[model samples]
Target chain A: MATPVLTVKGLTKNFGKLCAVNQINLQVNQGEVFGMLGPNGSGKTTTLGMLMGVVNPTAGEFSWFGQPPTHHIRKKIGAVLEHPIFYPYLSGQKNLELNATIKQTDFNNIAKVLDIVELTARRNDAYKTYSLGMKQRLAIASALLNDPTVLILDEPTNGLDPMGIAEIRTIIKRIAADGKTIILASHLLDEVQKVCTHFAILRKGNLVHSGPVDDVGKGEEIVEVIAFHDDLPAHLNQFQGTKEVKKDGQFYLVKMNNGFHSAELNRFLFEKGIVVSHLATQKKSLEKQFLEILAENNTH
Target chain B: MLHLLKIDLKKLTSYRTFWVVCGLYFITLGFTTASGMEFLKWLANKSVEFGATININRIPLYHFPDIWQNVIFVSGFFKLILAFMVVISVTNEFTYRTIRQNIIDGMSRTEFLLSKMLTNVLLSLLSCAMLLIIILITGFIYSPEIIWSEIFTDAGFMFAYFLEMFSFLSYTLMLGLLIQRSGLTIVVLCLSHMLEAIIKANIDDVTPGLIPFFPMESITNLVEMPFARYAFQEIQDYVSLTSVAIALGWLVIFNYISYLKLKKSDL
Candidate 1:
């Protein structure tokens, strides 16, 4: 197995008597896009802040490429936490240049980063002149100026329009494809499910669930079948291995037992002379798993 | 360190408010010098009317020079303005959440503190140089017999003044770190200066000697002459080297406290 690009073990942080981030362990392997899913004030920002060394961890330790939080390790990590704070009066290129200087990066990368963010046309514009989405892109460009081994972003698409979101998503996906480990912290579960291969769910400063996204809601295949008639729910249970059947107007929602296939159920229904208007098979979304985890925590 | 200093300079230079303040300083100095030269002319005329031996040759001695005196006088004004500017320079990083970014960008707390100190020192030196150039030009144009000795003496005064300014800026930087707001620190410094002035007014015997130890007093004494000449038999007795030492001591104490606070505080 390839070495993990980032390793966070038993990370904990406190703001006075209040624990803002409980003991949590996470890892992002080389070239993997890992998502940190959470709601507002769920300690997602705090955890990222600690990883970037902006916030001091009250307990536990983290290592990047098996090295501690030294300058050498930080040089290989790029991050955008919450909002991007730059010199508002300076041009975007100037701001990126300053960051590049601090990281001892090549000056030539400034233009390349601007091109990557599609901000090459507005690189000379002052930061205050840019729109919110443009500012966010510039912020990402600053992070990417060093061509870091790992990229950590906090809500990379928070205030972006759909078009802008697509643009940024494509950029992130491309970066990850280029063999850079990416850690995305966001409240948008759909985006996480679409872009990340691995995920960690945090709630109220605690890590509730974490692992491969494919393994989140294991052992079941959920299929939604819509029929032309509203009485289709009455006959839905005839399908073998059907765990539950629920009626939603003209549709019957079916969840099959572990190892059951949607094709087998469709074939069985067709053989029984029941016409299926619509049959769709899908893994449970990250949203469903996330809500389930939060609900479970509340119950406990 | 040089990279950090360059970033600091770039930030300070980019601020529109900095240029606005500089423009105001130049305009105010111009008005002050014109008015001061008029007053000197009036004094010369009055002396002639009173039948005093007011020779044209000695008029330069009585009047000093144009704008040179204004330049020295403006040091007090610039000291106050620059002190406030220095406070904002350090505090804004905390107020605007840039300090977190700076640290995340790989700067240690010590590096951050040292960068501010170095920036303030460089700016103070730049201000001193501008004031000196203004004085020399004004003095040469208005009075050919300008005393270079007085300029050297003024330089000495400003050296002491720079130390006092350094002390106040360092103390304000610490106060900014502790309070985490530029406005609050300014208010506190303003109120403290006023309170100290009131205290000095009521207790002249001891306050003049003691006030020099406070941050503001040290700055005031550094920019302006000490008033102890009127109350004491010898000027040297009142303006001891201890005052300068005390000012330096304040810088050390405040910087140490700021470092400790920065190391322990949560970002």
Candidate 2:
């Protein structure tokens, strides 16, 4: 297996009497669009903070590319913690210049970063004059000044409007398409589900569930079928690769095992003389799996 | 280190408030010093109206050797305004949360501290340069036939004045780190000055020797009452080494405390 981009082992953080982040273990792979899913007050930001050296970890340790996290490694990783921070009095271009200086990035990257963030026209404008969305874009531009291999953003769209959120999402997807490793921490499940290739659900400083999003409900396929005949449930159970059939009012939810698809089920039903009037395939989304993860945590 | 200083200075210079305050301070120093002879001319004539021979030409205040001490003393007060500038400079990093951001961008804790110290040193140097300009221009206007060697007479006071300004600014930088808010930091700075004075006064009355050892008293003694030397009062013939040592010591302490605060706290 390839070496993980990040290896977090038994990480923990505490603020006096409050244990803000408990023992958490995680491994992020290179070029993975990893989403740290959590609700408000969860340990998502704290975990990211510990990884970035902002907040001191109370226990355990984490490394980048199999090496301990250090200033050198940090230069290769770009991050935005909490809010988009910049000197308000400085122009957008000057702000990136400062970031470039700190990161020891070449002065040439300034123009390229501004171009990527699409703030070239407003490069000379003071940061205070930019809207929230513009400020966020400039922040992304600053992060890109180092041309980092890994990008970490906490709540990138926390306060954006719908259009602004979409704009940011588009930019993120574009960046992800370039195959850069991304670690996004957000409370918005919809945003995470839409953009993330993998996710880890965090609750009360604990990782309840984590894995590839594709494996959330396994490879099982579910089909909503409404048949002219009344005994569709029995027919579905009798079909090959049908794990179980759940009844939901007039429709039946048929759970298919691996190596099966909705077409195969439809073909089986047709051969069994059960003329299905309506059949619709359903794909399990991260939202459904995330809710289940949270529900599981709450019940415990 | 140079690159870091360059970056920090760029950030500071880009801010409008920085240039405004610094410009106002520089101009205020130049204007006041340039108008010094005018003020003396008025005072001399006023004294003459009372039939007193308080001759401006006879007095050695504006002449060589003494002008250095006199200008340094007057320009030393500029540190108070400059302290507010320093307070704003440091507090801005906290207010905008850029100090932590700068670290996140890749600067080490030591780099950040060094940058601020460098800026303070630069401010003191710039103030000294301004003081030099005012003194040179006025010195030539008042006494053009002086020896070139005498131009820097009592120059030790200028150096002492630089230490005094550096020490005070560091004191305010310490407060900036401690409070991290402009208004509150200034409030605490002013209150501490008043409080130190009050405490020193009571302590001075109760015990004479201890008063000179007070924090503010030690700093204030560095230049040794410039006005009295102009009046030919029995003052110390030169800048006191004890006060210089004490001021430099405070300078170190102030920066040490600031470093500790910056290091210990989560940026």
Candidate 3:
């Protein structure tokens, strides 16, 4: 049973002459890690801002949990948009307490969230003294103060080192495993690919593509093969499953139809008397699909 | 409402700038108002080149029916300190981007505006209470005779003082909302005061009646100068209803504009 956690209809925002977000309609379902993927200025932040009520939409409306959106509605949604916002003079624990106050939640939850973000040791230190990773974790802790059912994080791992990124990703995965509906927005397709069950791509304020992460770049499998023969492309094209074969310097790039395996292509080329020096199957990544979506929209 | 105020209290209590500004306001207001009689005695002891010596001690500066205006008039100058603090506190939300976060965390725009307004009111009430204590002690010590019936006389100035403080702080609040930067908001506040003064000076010769209606002018009029009575000069010895109404009117206008600014903008 996929209950709708959030539903946005024809949401739009315009800053003077610039259309930052335009006619965006989206639905986030329960117990799913939904990723909103877009490059900088593609309106991911703007859209999140509108959903959070910090940005007033020029048109349209959105609802939460099948009810109209309100400030009270937001109490159920924990969010960290753009940067980590807090009183720089306040300690990490005190900052989370402030969030708890606004959410009308228990102050006892502060300790739990701090422990989850692993900032328990330095919870008494002022926010201004915390490093970038610590500040980001404190923001995550603040967002989790209410144990919100819907967590919206924009660029949660932004500007963090590899270790910091892993820590946040681990926390997010743990939270999602608890059956919380999480909306993760990032420009990093790898992050989305690793954590998201469903994803949407936005380009120039328009939602270019949206579907399950598994369906990205469907209907095609790409495998790279290097053969010494100059007629490698011709030989690879003769395979029944081969959709197209293009030459890239010393390698032949083979696009295979659905259900076609690199093993089948290798056997076909081997039987055709063409021994391949190098052969590798390319995994269709969200990065490739994102770029293809952007490129596809660019041509239109 | 209490939750919103509690959130602001949590943010401000741990803020160093808030404490520093508050300390400055108390020290300056205390040093200036609490030393009133000593400063007057020191002025009276000075010798005069003219025939007669100047003595302000004999003027009954803290007498009943006069102490209210005297203390409030002097204390009113330090409203600028409270106004400065208000501007910084309001502008700090923008600088820290906490205002946006507060709303994102589930505060309505009206709640955010009301929270700041409630803080201003709290500060004003506290200031008035402190002044009342000081006035009572100083009045008892300096007054020649304690008249039981007259102690509450002219105490309307306390309400006037509160209105004055709240109105000025509300003005700064509106400016802080208009100009989201602390330094820039303070600069504009001071410059606007100077501009109003310049305009008042120039327009006094033509239309003095309209002067009392100006935002700052009306707030300043709330506590008329009580020193003129020491020179045996007649002063407006009581709080005027007109001035109070004007101050309250400006207060409402400032807050309404601030609320509109908050609602209309994308924080």
Provide i-RMS per model in Å.
Answer: 1.7, 1.2, 0.7
Model 2 chain A: which ten-residue window has the lowest total lDDT? A212-221
In the range A9-42, model 1's lDDT, one tens digit per residue, is 8899989899999999988888789999988999
What TM-score results for chain B in every one of the models?
A: 0.75, 0.93, 0.94
Which residue pairs show backbone clashes in model 2? Answer: none
User: What local lDDT does model 2 show for residue A235?
Assistant: 82
lDDT of 2 by residue, B1-267 (tens): 787788789888888898899989988888886777778788767777633656566666678877887777777676788889999999999999899888787776778888888889889998888888878878877774789898876788878878888888889999999999999998888787689888877777678887766667777788866678666577774788888888788899999999888877766
Best by TM-score: 3
Q: Using TM-score as the measure, name the better of candidate 1 and candidate 3.
A: 3
Q: Which parts of model 3 are misplaced by more than 4 Å?
A: A227-230, A258-260, A275-279, B48-55, B205-207
Return the top candidate by lDDT. Answer: 3
For candidate 1, write residues B120-193 as lDDT tens digits. 78766766666566566556666656576554443455466467657777877787888888888889866868
lDDT of 2 by residue, A183-244 (tens): 99998878888888888988999988888877865667788999888777788899888998
lDDT of 3 by residue, B4-116 (tens): 77777777888788889899888887778778777766665654532155556667778876888888899988888788888889988998899999999999999999899
Displacement of residue B95 (Cα, Å) in model 3 is 1.0
